[model samples]
Target: MTDILGYRAKFGVLGPSTNTTVQPEMDEMRPAGVTNHYSRIIVDNANALSDETFLKGTALIDQGTVDAVRGVMTCAPDYLVMGMSAITFYGGAKGAEQWQSNIEEVAGVKSFIGSVSVVEAFKAIGGIKKVAFLSPYYPVANTEVRNFLSDYGFETVADHPFRAPTWTAIAEITHKQVREVVEQMNDDNVDAILQVGTNLCMARLAGRLEQELNKPVVAINTATYWHALRANGITDKVSGFGRLLEEL
Candidate 1:
């Protein structure tokens, strides 16, 4: 018996409880008949003034991920899309692969990770190598993102770190701030620019930025959702989220 609403596919989206942006943003990218089931990883107080506290918060999210996966799996989703990126970026290229492998092993379905998904987006868009990215993460997490991208042969030309005070605060960052960072990261040398941190919500902004910047501006939420759709053989081109969803 096929699911009535989710007859195309049911995607299990894993994000942190504090993230307020994933649901609405991913939902906007959702194609007809494709439903997104979000399973939030519990993180009560994701406040951080130092690297330790930031990592501590992420540790809580990390620990809670397996349960989140199991919870989403109960819905019998055909695929899983990671709406959180920090843990997935940990341990570099091989680490990301192992991380995704573990999630897929437990989920009993193919999972799309932000880190891997962004890389795939690069490949799909083509002509992307030297990339700059902005993230609402501590310097430590930024390092992991840099390492992960480097392992995939994408040289990190530059990066801008927001270091949002708390997990919830990441969503509070203004579009102007993000646009300025993208402008700062953009130059003749950079091939593309990307925004990490799913809660930061750059899906809509990215599409507009691509037109303004005249360069690829990938948003994690958009890439992960696109990966989930394409990996599952759902090829409906979603516009207004950037070229990866529309053109690619």
Candidate 2:
């Protein structure tokens, strides 16, 4: 057996306070020798995708993320992993790059987001240009994600929104429902399926989803963790997730 901390790669994860999936799922999927720490943005409300919710969440996020970065930087982790998918794709390609830069500035180290990681994961498997997306956000958030992917040159061959507003509800959503959403899209043009919203539970079922879909289905949490580990030169492979971690 090998020592997990021998690799000594620390991951800084930024997620909503209500997010229960990213931390545990990422930890479980993470290979040996890597340690993960979390920072949370307060999201007390989840009604409409109104400016108020966005403002409050963003403000809380600013404060929370700074603390997270500072703490993680002290540990001198090789890379920072922004675990929130929504923030990554909030302003499209430019927004993603800007956010990554901000993380780098704050942490004084390189960073990657769930959105960017999944894109890289797809490309690693020779998947580029086309993909299907499944989101657990409302219409406004859904549109934002679609535009973001488009800006990155990924064709949104199909997309569907779960129309969920609250994080509690989103977290309650089962893997079966998630799989159903993917099946509903049924787009043959897409080379892979991407599911966003790290709050949702998908890591536990990532390998199963790929097996059932007969194509690559990259979960936000799984891909982000995978990329973060690889970015830090820790190539330990994990199991029970999907082909990406199993083979990448």
Candidate 3:
């Protein structure tokens, strides 16, 4: 046995190999005593997203995900995180629960997926019924997310996606552009503003946007990390994100 029980507060993240935003977001959200590691799976390069592309990447994704967690399992991280939101949102509510259980079984450690963490954060903030969303994916990916959330019993009141073709473009998007997309999602009837793209740089602005919008504005990355920290009972107050993690 590697004896993972004796190490410090380390976390392992399973993310897309090309993802450029998950680490920065994790760094911003993690508290003083914690650290992070990453495992990358195949992802669309920069041109397009297609079923063929996803199919080609499936074996790589599965292998990389297992390898990432297994490698980190040596260090015995207290927790594991699935850093991609789309995969987390797959299979809906039933899928989310099974994924959590599967990760724990394979990793021999507690685990969380970004989408599940987002839902847990919503519950923590006492949000139910309805919410709005902003995404940086094409219509196909957008439909997947919508269906996942609806299956979880959350009404998708309204949503706007920028229809980006690749994850790299989503990560390369500037903060100013993200804020503009945020403006496009403004609605009076939605209970909150939810974003689901780890590639999107909405974490740093979560606090200010929530205050300005007068409702919870949850960046997917932020909520995921918040849920991880909370799941481990680590309650260090993280500022600059939003009231969800700061004042909750």
Candidate 4:
């Protein structure tokens, strides 16, 4: 029999079908004996981003999540990770909790979701209370992120929204653009700089920014994966992603 690699843990990652960055970022951070398997929540239309359009897209994602969860469960993963962020951050902290509950109910497995993962990441990093964040979401979604963080007791010191034209455009955002947003958001009062939107591809950039800014620069993908590994009791301490994976 062929040797199966992920004898330690198999992570089932769920993302929107239109997202192009989460799977690649997760694969880049995969440690020895830890494998990542993906299942996409189908998004039939890639419409221009707006409050109305974004909410509609999230509804589609919600509709598709159960089926995607079912499909990934067939892999018999040791844990689950939600690679998308919007839905989890939609209502607030309570909304995130309910979303997780729904996932556990349907998938019959515990999972690491973006909203809760980021909160846990903050706690792991010494209970940082002030933060700056960047996102490719519309104004409404960004508000939800702020609300969710506020509910967790962290104050958003500053926020930058890319307002990417479409779901696909979120993946097209360049590292230079992301760096500029991070630079614009940073200040002495900001304890950390958070990059939301898994499709924004900020993992490596977050590491570099952390060195430059001398503070935590957390990428959602990195935080989500880190939460999964630690929650599963696999503390392999990955490098190059960010301090979340390396130190915490």
| lDDT tens readout by residue for model 2, 37-145 | 7766655645535545644454555456766678666656667777777767778888888878887887787888877887788778775678888877665666778
Lowest summed lDDT across 10 adjacent residues in model 2 is found at 47-56
Residue 241's C-alpha lDDT in candidate 1?
86
lDDT of 1 by residue, 42-124 (tens): 88856888878888988899899999999999999999989998888999999988988988899999889999999999999
Model 2 TM-score, 2 decimals: 0.88
User: Which candidate number maximizes lDDT?
Assistant: 1
- Tell me how far candidate 2 lies from the true structure as C-alpha RMSD in angstroms: 2.9
The digit string of per-residue lDDT tens for model 4 on 1-248 reads 32289888888999999999999999999999898999998886567557888878778888899999999999888778999998999889888999899999988889999989999999999859999999998888889999999998999989988988888889999999988777777888989999898899889988988998889989999999998988888898888987888888
Q: Worst ten-residue run, lDDT, model 1? A: 43-52
How badly does each model clash, as a count of residue pairs? Answer: 0, 4, 1, 0
Model 4 TM-score on a 0 to 1 scale: 0.96
Candidates' C-alpha lDDT? 0.91, 0.76, 0.76, 0.89
The C-alpha RMSD in Å for every predicted model, in order, reads 0.9, 2.9, 3.0, 1.5
TM-score of each prediction: 0.98, 0.88, 0.88, 0.96
Q: Supply candidate 2's per-residue lDDT for 40.
A: 69
Q: What number of backbone clashes does candidate 1 have, counting pairs of residues 3 or more apart or in separate chains?
A: 0
Deviation (Å) of 56 in candidate 1: 1.5
* Per-residue accuracy of model 3 over 1-248 as CA lDDT, tens digit each: 33343234688877877788898888777777688877666544644566444434433554567766787788667788777776667678787788678778999888878788878888888856688888776556567678888887888877877665665777877778877877776777778888887877788787788888888888888888888888787888888999767976
